[model samples]
Target: MDGGGDPQVAGPVIAALMERAAGETRVAMSPETAKKLIGLGATVRVESGAGVTASIPDSEYEAAGAVVGDLASTVAGADWIFGVAAPDVALLSGAKPGAKVAAVFDPFRDRARTDAYAAAGYEALAMELMPRITRAQSMDVLSSQSNLAGYKAVLAAANTYGRAFPMMMTAAGTVQAARCFVMGVGVAGLQAIATARRLGAQVSATDVRSATKEQIKSLGAKPIFVEKVAGIEGEGSGGYATEMSDEYKAAQAELVSSHIAKQDIVITTALIPGRPAPRLISDAQIATMKPGSVIYDLAVAAGGNVEGSEPDVIVEKHGVKIIGFSNTPAHLAADASALFARNLFNFVSAFWDKEKGEIVLDEEIGTAIRLTQDGKVVHERLLG
Candidate 1:
């Protein structure tokens, strides 16, 4: 909590502000998470109704040892602020100086906001920047959330396709299984393949990373290698897909186009952080696809993998239906919130200092946190 100023404000004016902001104001925090914070010697100051939208009542937080406060007081002296979305500059400005803030911090999409947080002198941790190393696995919010996004992407695509995923048979004849082509075999892409196969689709997935081929096969899906052109590197730090060269992309397109014509559904999940999503499917390529086929772009918010895709809008061109979705994981809010909270907990555990009531950054953890620390962006590649 903000270390300065009297906890009991001097008079009615400050007390009134605290009263207005305090007591059972709803928050997204669950009881289990609230207890964890209290155990760490942090008090949970919530508005009277913060968690209502998430279905937990004010009484629930109080039962978990939280002291309800008005909005201004709750956030004013907060030692740390936790949220799913990147908080606005106004909220960060209100926080006591040097307070730690943790969130997804979509730096790629909201660089300006992050820059402002840096200017405000608050330590902002971007969970999305967690390293993809073995030691950092527990703290990886991106993979956890993207895993759900991948699962939901397939479900969304399945709903739009005319044919069923699995093979079926009737007295008349045997219905062949739907063919699914998945691009970018990252966490989400791999999940999409598994989900599609579970639904009985004959699934094939592609990625610049050769390592993903074995993973795809292990899930009982075929590994479709788009012709490898020059400059195709595999995976980057954190198991994220790195950018590919234009020549490599053209070759991939040629190979994918040939296979896509026969596919019943296509799910694309390739994304490069801070960059516009690589365009994998051209309008011409989509044109060759049969009518009633479905294409779901998981990177729709990053400008999409398919041509003519509009975020949250399903468009049809040349008989092929392209579905683009923004905020794919928002579809499973409760589950996503839980996983996200766990990631935050694990990350906070690494830095919290109980004795001093502040985070003590160890060498290793300091390096990790420095990936986006003190308002200066620092990554291995960026430093290079």
Candidate 2:
């Protein structure tokens, strides 16, 4: 909120606060989005130094017509609070009653936070719950962030591996291309395949959803699938892959065991919403991989898809290096922040009512993402 308390100011106050989570480098609002929000007749405030980790300075926000101030001044009387992760409930104490907070609440994993928000009379919008529909494509933060995380996963694995991704032919001898395998061809997996292929690796990918086979081939990668298996069509609601049957899991494990043994680099991106990541590689499977091989688990933060993968640690097994980051997109913070801010801006502007000078979310998106309203946990998924 503007410090002057200017009565001339119109529309709701939108504020972007600093992220409190450890290793969170991305900011929810960027200068680009701040400018767009201001154009929509809203007052935009950003906490000074909030974007420092993402390499965005306070001067940039000021130049974009956003008022920059400390945390207390930024949130004071604000109507809407924006954040990458949901800000601590304590931080929202200064906001107006029933203020709208739009961010990644991770409601299933952290119900206590949503409960606090409900008790505080704040409207909690969990961006991760944004429905997967054609109209909401531009507002999909998961896809935006996961795409970058997938590209980073492959690059990190390539860096850790002793061998080069591309083959070399010199006066000495011709070197073969490194073999890369991507598990779970979601947005992240597809990006992993594309990135690995760009790095000159012989890329192959697999997914429970057979529909992704063509997507893999389009990226010039081979598709390794457990064909003719029941439950192989595992695409779930919101385009996420669901848990497969025991029979399908066995077949997948068998196929992956043989394929992974030959892979020089493996990147796993499988994840089920509100559930632990499905295990893809076992300790025995890791041992089968060649010495000096590298594996990057993109789902380590969600309990991991590869055995022995630890967040932000390089675990070596049988001379194979397994690595992953709890917050993969934060490694490329600048771009990640830009895309994320745009996604939030897209969601808000799509529902902005010009005459009313406020955002009025329609039932489709509102019901899908709203976790709390009217001082209660209103989301059906979270209600007991």
The Cα local distance difference test for each model comes to 0.73, 0.92
RMSD of 2: 1.5
Give per-residue CA lDDT, model 1, range 1-384, as digits (tens).
234344643111101011112221223356667777667766666666656655667797789876666667667666677766656657544566656666666765776766677677767667677767887788788898889989999899999998788888989988999999999988899889889988999999888887777899999999888554653445665577787777777777788989889898999999987689999999998988889999999988888888899988889999988997688876776677667767776776676776666556667655654434565655343354
* TM-score for each predicted model, relative to the true structure: 0.86, 0.98
Which candidate has the top score in TM-score? Answer: 2
Model 2 pairs in collision: none
Q: Residues 1-384, candidate 2, lDDT per residue (tens digit)?
A: 332355766878999999999999999999999999999989999999999999999999999999999988899888899999999989877887888999999988899999999999999999988899999999999999999999999889988989888999989999899999999899999999999989999999999888788899999999998976865453566798887888999998999998999989999999998898999999999999999999999999999999889999999999899999999999999999999999999999999998888889999899999999999999998886
Instruction: Give per-residue lDDT, candidate 1, residue 184.
Output: 90
lDDT of 1: 0.73
Model 1 misplacement above 4 A:
1-28, 227-234, 363-384
* Each model's total of backbone clashes: 20, 0
